[model samples]
Target: MKRGDIIELIEDTTFYKKGKKAYFIGRSNFNPNKIEIVWVGEEQAYKDGDIDEFPARLFKQVEHGDR
Candidate 1:
């Protein structure tokens, strides 16, 4: 996913539960497969190497529209 895109946790994982809103910050500097994101409730802006990242396969891009 690209930076600034909204992502949702699509599957149950060891770290995050399903249905959490996160901002797609980009891929990890070390591992491109690891998509970095920050919880939306915590903060909207983020810097690489400063947050937890998960596998891109576990997340899906969230389309922006009315709730």
Candidate 2:
């Protein structure tokens, strides 16, 4: 998806904490297939500056209705 989009972890659980919502920061500069995201919920495990990177295929853009 595009940058600034909200995405949800769907299939990839190895990196993401399943079901957590994240803000799409952007795709990896070194690899277009990967994306970077910042956790945005109350999950205390992820603190400030915490970021996650995963394959673009593993995330789905959150629809307006889903918000």
Candidate 3:
């Protein structure tokens, strides 16, 4: 996906470790089912913990802004 694609997290629990869980980071340069992004900013947070990054596979591109 490009820089502005809205996405949601998919269930990629298998890829992550036991304690670490994948989360939905913001948009970045990515390829479908191959390349994904993980947000690494200090402000990043998921649930009650700090989520630095997540796999691009977790996200599904949202196409609402096009219309």
> Which of 1 and 3 is ahead in lDDT?
1
TM-score of 1: 0.76
Candidate of highest TM-score: 1
lDDT tens readout by residue for model 1, 1-67: 5677888999987766899888877788999889878878766345433577888888888855233
Q: Give the TM-score of candidate 3.
A: 0.33
lDDT of 2 by residue, 1-67 (tens): 5666778888748555666778787888888899987766733534656667778888788843232
Clashing pairs in 1: none
Per-candidate TM-scores read: 0.76, 0.67, 0.33
lDDT of each: 0.77, 0.72, 0.42
lDDT of 3 by residue, 1-67 (tens): 5543444555536554333322234443453344333432322443346433444555566543232
Ranking by lDDT: 1, 2, 3
**Candidate 3 residue 50 C-alpha distance from true site, Å:** 10
The clash count for each model shown is 0, 0, 2
Better of 1 and 2 by TM-score: 1
Candidate that beats the other on lDDT, 1 or 2, i.e. the better one: 1
